[model samples]
Target chain A: MMDKEKIKFTDEELVARFQQGDERAYIELVKRYKDRLLNFVYRYLNSFEQSEDVVQDTLMKLYTSAHMYREIAKFSTWIFTIAANLAKSELRRLKRRRVVSIHTMGYDDSEYEIPSEDFDPEKETTSNYGEKQIQEAIDTLPDQFKTVIILREVQQLSYEEISQILGISIGTVKSRINRGRLRLQKLLKDLKVR
Target chain B: MDCYSFDKVISDYIESNLSAKQKQEANEHLAQCPACSEKLADMSQLLGALRTLPRPVTRPDFESRLMARIERQKQQKESPFIHVFHEYSRVISVAAAVLLFVATSLFVYTSVVLPGSPASVPSASIRSVEPAAALPAAAAGVRPEQAGGVAEKTLPDTNRVQNPDYNSRIMMVNE
Candidate 1:
């Protein structure tokens, strides 16, 4: 039984240990990634609960598919790729379940309107209000731009790292980050104004 | 650098991707150009906000929840088929029993009951009669008795009366 506090294995080493049936290594691996993965997924999903679930799901995959984790790729890259793919598919599932109420009750409504119909004023006065606005701005971005921006700006991943994760060229990552940032700037200009 | 060229390199400039010489040129252009400088400032502020955005912390039980979930997942993956079977075990067993019952019943009917029935072959023999049953009252009684006896016995000797001359004599006598 390894000391939970004293185990200092790297992700790859821990994964190797996990494959060797070290349950402690698995716990340590989950501890190492839970927060970072949660933050990364929360930014992409814009829902903390869903992000938590997705992180759990991602870790579960990492646990079960430990044998599939060859050492050729960095464990962070492989794990982050799993996280990204799960987040993307979750977004697709959410999108499919999202009903387009553009012509509700035979009345034309703006499709791009932020769904503040259920907004609670009490919740708006809470802490980190600007952060919520910024998140909403990020949420308005296109999926391609949204993904690269979150991976870059939020996760602070290098362009080359993001390129590998997204399977795109570094040039594409750079251009997307630039475009995403510019779009975000436009959307959040009002935040600066206030 | 003119504004057009500055626009293209501004992102690289903010990200520190520009060469030193190009950086110096951009700095010189920014010194002379307030518009481009303000654009750069906006981009910087945006990047700062994004980088400094407050992240939500996972709850204290995040690991426990994940581990519990992982354990559940491992148990499921260990027996994916068993999980499905367990979920629908009653329905599946009932369906299997019903299918087995139907199959066994069919097997018994075909192999034992059907082949042993005396009426099975004789029913085919009764259908063999074609024209001679039209001989009026006399032949009608004979036809029915033959048809009835054919159900319990092998076919009667129809080869005797099936002769054309015999049929003609029987038809003349009847008329």
Candidate 2:
């Protein structure tokens, strides 16, 4: 049997139209990916505004790379791969500029203000210290553990997807996730996790 | 706590990341063991916390500004090599008209050419060069029958069936 195309017309047809100078298809693509890419980029940059810039830059890259878009993976994975790389590069740029991670460090996670009615079997504090304490603890983790944790927890990606995206063996992915969780537990040792 | 040999499998068991066989073995171990159960509970709690960390929201106007910049930057980043390739495709039909001219042409060249088909498939024949030392010395200590020949100018080249010189050489050797 002929291989049913992994990529539908919705995917390639939109890209092909963009290549053929249909700026409107580009618009549709931007609309489709903008928010999703923003979320991916936001993970890298603590600032929402900077993530917006990253998303823009990533889209421009995708448009020009339209012809290069071979349907090798789920478009979501491919696009997020680009977005993540861009976000990382942007992070590096800020590092070069010496924008101290004080933003990352001295976070007023007052915004994480959990509407404190209580949603759990155990009532946990929604204090800023808890967010900072958790962030500091996560930030201290080795980059390998840190990345897997963020991808699995924050991005809510599957272990298989994390394995493919990070180019690690599945065992390594599982190990890192396990190790990261253990570390996070150690960081929030006082918190009731159950 | 009873120290178990399969502590390495703890993470695997807690996550249910183990294969069915591994899970069965781990469960078997846990059924009789309480230490493993406590460890499993702790690990499960940690895993639950990690999976439940709140997903944050993206700042507004995040999409539109990104789209606008990508559009403008898209043109500057447009690859010139792609255009050159597309243009080169059009030049092919021009070849049908240009080759129609055959004026008197004296093509001069100086090169020793080794003639062979350009498209010929390659094959290699390996001929072994055996040294005379490799010839086995038989019972009389001269040489074996199978690898008999140790080529000498004095010895008759009797292997050549068509050569008349073979009979003279054989007679001289016999006498």
Taking all chains together, each candidate's TM-score versus the true structure is 0.67, 0.53
**Model 2 TM-score, 2 decimals:** 0.53
Best by TM-score: 1
Q: Is the docking of candidate 2 incorrect, acceptable, medium or high quality?
A: incorrect
Tens digits of per-residue lDDT for model 2, A65-91: 877776666666667778777877887
Candidate 1 Cα outliers beyond 4 Å, as residue runs? A4-7, A100-129, A190-194, B77-82, B86-175
Summed backbone clashes in each candidate are: 0, 0
DockQ for every model comes to 0.23, 0.10
Could you tell me how far off, in angstroms, the CA of residue A56 lies in candidate 2 after the best superposition? Answer: 2.7
Q: What is the lDDT of residue B131 in candidate 2?
A: 34
Q: Which ten residues in a row have the lowest lDDT in candidate 2 chain B?
A: B120-129
